[model samples]
Target: MDPDRPLIPAELNRYARPDVLIEKGRLRFLELNISTRLGGDAVARWLADAYIGLCPESGLRRPPSTVAARCEALNRMRHAGNGHGGTGRLLIPIHSVIDVSGARQRRDRIQPVIVAGAQRLGFEVFQADLADLSLDAAGRLLVSDVPLDVVLLRWYGSDRIIDDGGGLAALCAADRAGTVGLFPRPESALVSSKAVLSWLREDCDAGVLGPADRALVRDHIPWTVCLGLDGDPEVERNLLRMAAAERDQLVAKPAVGQSSNEVIFGNQMSAQYWQSAVADAARESPLVLQRRVESGRITMPFRDRESGQRVTTRVPFVLSLFMVDRAAAGVLARHMTPDLPDGDVVIGMRHGARPNAVLLAPAS
Candidate 1:
C-alpha cells in the first residue's frame, strides 16, 4: 500500500477485501463450477443454475447444465426490437476510464455486475473494457458478429463514471441511430449522481410522494454528508457552498471516483481544505453534496434459499434506483449495515421481485 494513499482499513484493503462470500449454504455459492471453465459460458451456467433452483422451490439444487440451457434461450429477447433492422445493437462503450486517474483502482476487485445481470436476464452480453472500447472504428462493435439488443453502459466506481458523458451520449446516439432499443447507463450514473437525482425528483414532483418514496425517504434520508466524487471546478465551488450553506455534513469525492474512496467529511474536512479538493474533483464533472440514506437493494427474479425456488428476497443494501432511460424501471431496496457509509454492490441474485416492494416504470 502506498503511504500517500488515503488511510485504509482491513475492509478497505483491495488486496484481501470484504470476503467474497462464495458459498454460504449447500446451494448458495459464487465461484463458477470449476468443472466447466468454458468461456463466457461459465458465467452463463451460474445464471441457469440460479434460475433452475428457483423453479424447483422445493429446496432442491439444480444441475449446472440445466441452468445453461435456460440462459441460452434469452437470445431473442436481447434483440427483440432491433432484430428486424431496427437498430444494429446499442453500443455502450467503456473507453473513457482507460487513462483517467484519481480514485482507487478497484476495477479488478469490483464484481462483474453487468455480466451477472446479463446472465440472469439470460443474454449473452458482450463486454469491452476501456481499451477495447477506445479504438475509434466503425466496426468497434460490429452488428453482424453477435446478436445484440440493449447496450448496458457500465462502470465500477463513481469517480470516473459520472464524467463519462461523452461515452454515454455516444451510446444514446448509437441506440437511436443503430439497431438497439435501449441504452441504460449504470445505476451509479443515473441514480447516484446528485445532479441527475435532483432532476428526477423535480420531474417526478407531482406535489406528493408515492407510498414507496415516503417509505424510502423516512426521516430525510438519515445520512450525514454529501459525497461528491467529481472534479469540475464549478461543481467543486458549488459543493463548497452546499457544505457551507445547504448541506453542512458533506464529503469531497473525485469526479472519477469509487464509492467511499476519497470520501472526507466531518472533522476531517475544513470548509477551506475541501474546497481545494472539491475544486480538484470538480474539474472532471459536476460533483454533488447530498444527504445520505440508509440504502439497500434487492435484484428481481431471486431464488428462495431453502426451497431453491424463484422467490424475491432482500440481500445487501446499496441505495440505488434501477431504471431504463428517464422512466423509473425498478427501485432497489438494499439492506446496508446500520452504521457504515458504504454498502455491498452485488447483494443477492434471486427470482423476479414482488410487485409492490419496488417502483418500476412501464414496459418500453
Candidate 2:
C-alpha cells in the first residue's frame, strides 16, 4: 500500500529535523546524478558555475563539457588564484557503466558533493575513478595511471553494475596507503546484512539489526553448515563463534550490493553464498550461493492508504537512513520497484537537520 508521504521523510528527515546548521547566507542547488554525469560537457558547465562562483580568477577559455574540459575549468579556477589548499589540489575520476539509470537520477540524490565539500573545507579538491568505469561511456581507466593521495572507495548498498564498487576496498592497500576514506565506513557497508548482528555479538549492540542479526555472524555454528570450505579454520570458528554469541534469523546481504539485487529471506541463502562470492550472488552475477542468512518474519509499521491507522505489515519499501562521516545525513523511504525493489522516496540531506556526530546509534 502506498502512502501519500513516504516514511523516509516521515520517520527521520534531516531537513525537517532541528540540528542542521544554517548560516544566514545565499545558497545554490546543483545535482550530479547518473544521467547528468553522462551528459558529458553539460554537467561540466554546471560545475564551472560553482567553481567560478567560488573563485573569480578561474579565467574562462570556453565552457567545457567533457571530463577533461571540466577538470581544466576547475583547475584554472581554483589553482589560478592563491588556491584554497596548502597542499596542491588533485583531480580523479571513476568510470562506470553501472551508474544510476532510468527514472532515478543520481544528481537528484547527491551532487558533486565530495569535491564541493572538500574545496570549501580548504582541502584541494580532486577526483578519480578506477582505470575503467563502465558507468561512463569513457569506459577508459580514470586514475589507473596517476598516483593518488586518496583511494575514494564507493559504497552503495548494492552492486548491479560493473563499477558499482564491489571490490573497491581490497584495492585500497595497493593504490592508496595513506588514507582510504570510504564514502561510508565498513560499519555502514556491513550493517545492511545479517553480518551486522554477528559483528555486535562480541561488541554488544542494539536495534532492529540486533542480536538476531548478530547471531547470523560469528559465535553461532549449529546454525551454519560447512558448505564451501572456509579458508582458515580459525576464520570459520571466529565466524561461527560470533554468530552464536549474537542474534539469529536475519537478512544476509551481499558485502557490496545495492538496493535489492540479492535481497532475500535469510533462510533462502546457501552456505556457498556466504563466503568469497557474496557480492557476486547478491548482485545477480555468476557467483553461486554464499552463506545462508537467518529468515523468519518481517513486519514494518505502515500507514494504511484508506484507514489513517498505522498498520504493522510487510511491504518491499524498507526504511533506510544515511550518514555523512557518521552524521545523520539523510533519510528515505522507498517503494519497491523491480530493479531497486526498494526505490527511494524523496531523497534529500539538508545540513541543518542532521544529527550530532557525537551521538550515534548502532545499526538497528
- Model 2 whole-model lDDT (C-alpha atoms): 0.32
| Cα misplacement distance, residue 196 of candidate 2 (Å) | 3.2
Per-residue lDDT of model 2, residues 204-253, tens digit only: 33344566545543333212222123235565556444433332243333
TM-score of each candidate structure, all chains considered together = 0.38, 0.33
Tens-place lDDT per residue, model 1, 147-172, is 34555433434335444434444444
> Which 10-residue window of candidate 1 scores lowest in summed lDDT?
29-38
lDDT, model 2, position 87:
39
What shift in Å separates residue 190 of candidate 2 from its native position after superposition? Answer: 5.6
Model 2 misplacement above 4 A = 1-92, 97-110, 128-151, 155-193, 202-257, 265-317, 336-364
